[model samples]
Target: MDFLTLLQLLDTTVRLATPLLLACLAGLYSERAGIFDIGLEGKMLAAAFFSAAFAYSTGSVWLGLLAGIGVSLVLSGIHGLASITFRGNQLISGLAITMLAGGMTVLIAQDWFKQGGRTPQLEGAARFEPITLPFAETLREVPFIGPLYYELISGHPILVYIAFALVPLTWWILFRTRFGLRLRAVGENPASVDTAGVSVVALRYSAVMICGVLCGLAGAYLATALQAGFVKDMTAGRGYIALAALIFAKWRPWYALWATLLFGLFQALELRPDLIQQVIGVKVQVQLLGALPYILTVVILAGFVGKAIPPRAGGEPYVKER
Candidate 1:
């Protein structure tokens, strides 16, 4: 309604969008390489648990981040082995990874911490604190620019900036590099890529590994930066939302950022129900607001928004002789 209120909304949108943006990019990389990964949620969940556990034990967030990335990479490697090496069904393998992470995180958490699937509360160096920008204090008195800079952009943790910065980097990598060209070619036509003297399996494996690294960072941000420690299923379907976002963006990096931000805005509104009611001057149900992301996903899939064409070789195992 007002300028300050708008700034607060934008700030909340950025915070909520960070993980979604990360996970969406992860999915984009994997799917663009012809690997349909439904296990992004699982990887994030497992990484969050392990990162929190290690951070609490060692009192170092950096080590926790590395542990998270390591665990995620291991799971990604498993997916790669099952689907690429064994040539199994990619969807089933991804589902298995998700189920495995879901059960394993809780099981290990209870056994180690005895807190019913929650790690010990993190403090001090185990957590990420918001960094204040250089001119935040001095520019607080400025008009529209002041709140935009000081309130919305200046107070987030380091990972938030990294997540946003990744958009352009991803765009460049997917469009401007030789590897990017080969990766896209493989997804569209693995046989053609193979004929060109490139290893399809190797390229797909690399993409999945990058996905794992990004998902690991997303999980670490959730456990250490957004919250003090990991909770059971803290990801709470953000992975699925990110997948939907990937589809919504049609696998484009810049569009993925906008899509994640739109979903995040819905989430921010759900968190502040009164604000929605104020804006619309009508009573709004929180359940309806919460369901917005899933509804959008279904609509996009049903072609209400537009036709979404996936990579030609997506969800298919590449056979050299086939």
Candidate 2:
């Protein structure tokens, strides 16, 4: 491929990677705090629907984002209540949340918009547009750096930059802060955390809430930024892919970024089958390419790639007297 083509590929990869990166980080935070959240997909779906609905109604993308985050947090709170407060099975609780979101988004959409589970098409301030970076126009003729800067590095919505910047921030928070230490400790050994005079429930709740916020942003990006509005199940299993990415990254922030990008590259290739065939000089099945993320997930989970050890207390409810 030529340098320009390569830059185009990189640009596509970044766009596709944004939501996966956000959802992967969401799962990382929840799982690292001993909460196995299979409901990331659900939260994103719910947020996407609500964000789109609100944005279309109010003509403000910012309000839509806030609405998405609020809905996601409510669902996260439900999960926290069921798992932490009631000490129920975390997996089942997560599954319930996902199912609930799946059903409610479609139901509400059909009732409100009468478009068979799609919100009204968004326009103007309701949708996010790309922000051109400084020097992009000035450097458009500067050899290899020109296209790289203007084409690849510029012209994404602000959320894309925020998603990328979050990697280092998440890394720092999980490794460099006292809350990070306690959060990790709670996931590993809740009893030990309790003995140290910390509230295990509180930390786990906080982690799950953070997960909700990130998933909310991921949904908003999809509904308002990536597309004009929400459709039925627009998330389309990104949450599961993100979960797989979390496992693939072994719950590390930097690795999560790389893993999501790899998956995004696979998706980008799927979108451009001609490019893949050109690179390989062989006919490639689009179906197989589309299945790449799930295939990788199964491989990683089966330990064919490598052992991915989860947190010790993951998927278990903490009991103070146990």
Candidate 3:
């Protein structure tokens, strides 16, 4: 491939990976706090739909983004209440939340937009514009690597930066701050955290709510930044993939970022039908290529390197005494 072609591929890879990175990091917040969040996909889908709808109505992308995050946070709050406060089964609660969010998003979109569960097209200003790098443009006139930096790193949406930036912040939160220590302690043993005068339930609720906010931003990125507008179920199991990435990364934010990028590369390949045929030298059906990443997920989980060990108290609710 040519230099420009490689640069384009890198750009596309980052674009495709942003949603997964965002969602995986979002899931990481909850899971690291010993909460299993299987409903990330639903949250993303709901937020995407709501974001597009709000943006279309108000003609303000920022307002739409806030609306999306707000809706998903409320939905996630329900899950937190059911699983953490009520001590419900985390898996069942997450699944139910996903189903509810997905169904409600579709139903609301269909009823209101009348586009059969799809939103209207978005305007240019309603979408995220690519940001050009300061020195890369000037340096592109130098040589080959300069062109590489210019094309590959420059002109990406603001969300892409946020998605990558989140990795370090997530790591800092998990390993640095006082709340991070308490969160980790809660995941390790809620009783211990409670004994130490921390509110375990409150911490878990906060973690889950943050997960909702990240998932909401992820959904909005899919609609407004990744694509022009919302379509019915456009998230298309990306949330599950993000979950897989979270586990694959062993609950680490930077590792999850890399894992998400790998899957996103597969997604980018699937989008380019010819690339698969050329690279693999087989007339692989589009459906099969589309299935490759999920297949990989199953294989990775099924002892390719041994069983993945989750946090000991993950998915268990804590009831603290006053």
Candidate 4:
């Protein structure tokens, strides 16, 4: 393929990667604190539905974003309560959240809008629009750099920039701060943290709630920015894909970018079958292309891409001694 075509594919890759990046990072904070949450997908789906519902009702995208985050936070609290407060099974609690979000979104959409299982198409101010960068049009003819700046690097929603920018911030927060040290410590050995005069439950809850906020952004971006409205199961297993990415990256911040971007490329390729045909000289099945991400997930989880050892105390309930 040519350079411009390659740039176009990359543009799509960036767009598709944004939500995954957000959700993957969400998982990172939760798992890193010893709370094994598999409910990222549920939180995203619930957020997507509620955000769209609120935005359509209020005609304000900001309200919708807040609603999304609010719903995700509630779900995160539920996860925390089940696994932390009650010391229940973390996996079961998380899976229950996913199932709950899946059914609740559709049921509520049909009850509220009567559109089978989707919200009304968001319009005007209720939806996010692409913002052109300051120098994009001015530098459109300055050679390769101009087009690269204009087409690939510019004209995206604010959240796209936010998602990519979080990479460094995540690394900094996880490594450079006192809270980061405690969070990692809590995940590795909660007993030690407790002995050090720290409340392991508090740190784990904070991490899970942070996970909720990021997942909220992911869902809002999906319903308001990427698509015009919410549909049934719009997340389409992206939460699971993000979990796989978390494992693939061995739970590192910078590596999450590469892993999500790699999965995002598959998503982009799914939309650009013509590009695939050009490179391979044959039209490929859409189903086959769509399965690429899942295949990678299985491969990574099966220890194919090096053993991804999770946190030592992951998925274990911390029991304090008398």
The regions of model 1 sitting more than 4 angstroms off are: none
- Residue range 1-322, candidate 4, lDDT tens digits: 9989999999999999999999999999999999998999999999999999999999999899999999999999999999999999999999999999999999999999999999999998898788899989999999999999999999998889999999999999999999999999999999999999999999999999999999999999999999999999999999998998898888999999999999899899998899989998999898987887777767777887777789999999999999
Candidate 3 residue pairs in backbone clash = none
lDDT of 3 by residue, 1-322 (tens): 5567667777798999999999999998898889999999989998898888898888888888998899889889988988898999988988998889778987999999898888899887787778888987789887887878788778888988998999999899899999998887888788998888778888999999999999999999999888988898899999998998887887888889898988887777777778656666877777876777677667767868656667778988776657
RMSD of 1: 1.0
- Every model's Cα RMSD, please? 1.0, 1.0, 1.9, 1.3
lDDT of 4 at 110: 98
User: Between 2 and 3, whose TM-score is larger?
Assistant: 2
| Cα error of candidate 3 at position 275, Å | 2.7
Instruction: List residue ranges in candidate 3 displaced over 4 A.
Output: 276-288, 320-322
lDDT of 2 at 132: 99
Kindly list the per-residue Cα lDDT of model 2 for residues 39-153, writing each as its tens digit.
Answer: 9999999999999999999999999999999999999999999989999998999899999999999999999999999999999999888999999999999998988999999
Clashes of each: 0, 0, 0, 0
lDDT of 1 by residue, 132-200 (tens): 999899998898888899989999989999999999999999999999999998889999999999999
Question: For every model shown, what is its TM-score relative to the native structure?
Answer: 0.98, 0.98, 0.94, 0.97
lDDT of 1 at 224: 94
